[model samples]
Target: MSKVKLFSYWRSSCSYRVRIALNLKAIPHEYVTINLVKDGGEQKKDHFLKINPFGFIPSLEVNGDNNQKSIIFESLAIIDYLENINPEPSLYPKDLIDRANAIAITESINSGIQPLQNLFVLAEIENLGGNKDQWAKQLITKKFKSLENIMTKTAGKYCIGDTITIADVFLVPQVYNAYRYGVDMSQYPTIERVNKLLEEHEAFKAAHPSVQPDAPKQ
Candidate 1:
């Protein structure tokens, strides 16, 4: 491989998922910080749009011989790509059934809960003349309560059976967004507990938004 590069937006939850996975796999990759919030997302530019027609952040570029390449968009896909590169110390279980279940777990809430509360979705909700803050808080609380129920079935030191699977990576960022919008985490003690433990892990620590170069001049 020539080099690995990840184009990312720090505050984006999807980017956070890829960051955690790359760190866990001990991959060396340069971070290209894209400005997601500045002037309607530089990601939408024609240059970048070609990279990902969807024009979303968190695109992973795997450079290899002859400029031959692989590109992965979507946080979960990038994580799976990282796993394929370094399978030792596997984040995924070997049993096919176990792996299937694991993928199911991550996809469940990642699709279920996150979309309804995204930045763009939230803005749309606000534009509809509803109380955005109140609606966000309400929906988040309900979704988390649902998540708490599902998580209790298989949470240990992590979200799924003691391993720091992709689910955990997905969970932490979602909760972080919850807190950002003033949702009281007190209602979800289990989620809070997991995040506290995960935050100390090297991957999560390195991936934290505060540590990102583009996070605000301080």
Candidate 2:
């Protein structure tokens, strides 16, 4: 296999999802850790910028037919790319409608909720004299409840169904962040259950921040 390298920071939910997908697909890859906080972050380094100009973590590369191919940037894109290649475990439902619904929920969190609550966004809110704590609560609760409503219709044992899918990939990490910031999960049982189940899975266990290649020395 050609070299498949992942540039990521362990704590990043986006990075976590890509790592979980890679493991679940049984793909071997070299993980290059990016310290998002150290030395002004490896992501900002000139050498890394050539790989991912956006200065974001979790940019995946693999040798392609022509050259080194950049597969995905954001966490959501990375999971989608995995579904495209290793359809076996079937992270996305194969049927058209089911697939669309599956993708919709995944996108729901990836785009609808996550973007508004990331560190950068939260920090920006704080800088603007916005009530950072309340802003977090407001955005997170609204989205969490919205996702719970959506999950009521779409979820099985996992996010999309009894089977694990790309939805789980988004759900697990986002919930982790939510919890870190004290987002009350008891109000959303389905989401709570899904996260509980994913935690027991080996792929997610292995891909956790502490075990990541570039996790801080502390």
Best-fitting candidate, measured by lDDT?
2
How well is each residue in 52-166 modelled by candidate 1, as lDDT tens digits? 7788779988865578776778877788778777885577766676567667667766887778777788889889987877777788788888777767776788877777877
- Scored against the true structure, residue 183 in model 2 reaches a CA lDDT of 81
- TM-score (all chains, Cα) for each model: 0.91, 0.91
What pairs collide in candidate 2? none
Model 2's alpha-carbon lDDT is 0.82
Q: Global lDDT of each model?
A: 0.80, 0.82
lDDT of 2 by residue, 1-218 (tens): 56578888889888888998998888878888778878767789998888888877788886766775865587767666666766668687777877787788888888888788877887899899897667776787889888899899988888877888888877888888788778889999989998999999999899888787667677
Error at 29, model 1, angstroms: 0.5
lDDT of predicted model 1 = 0.80
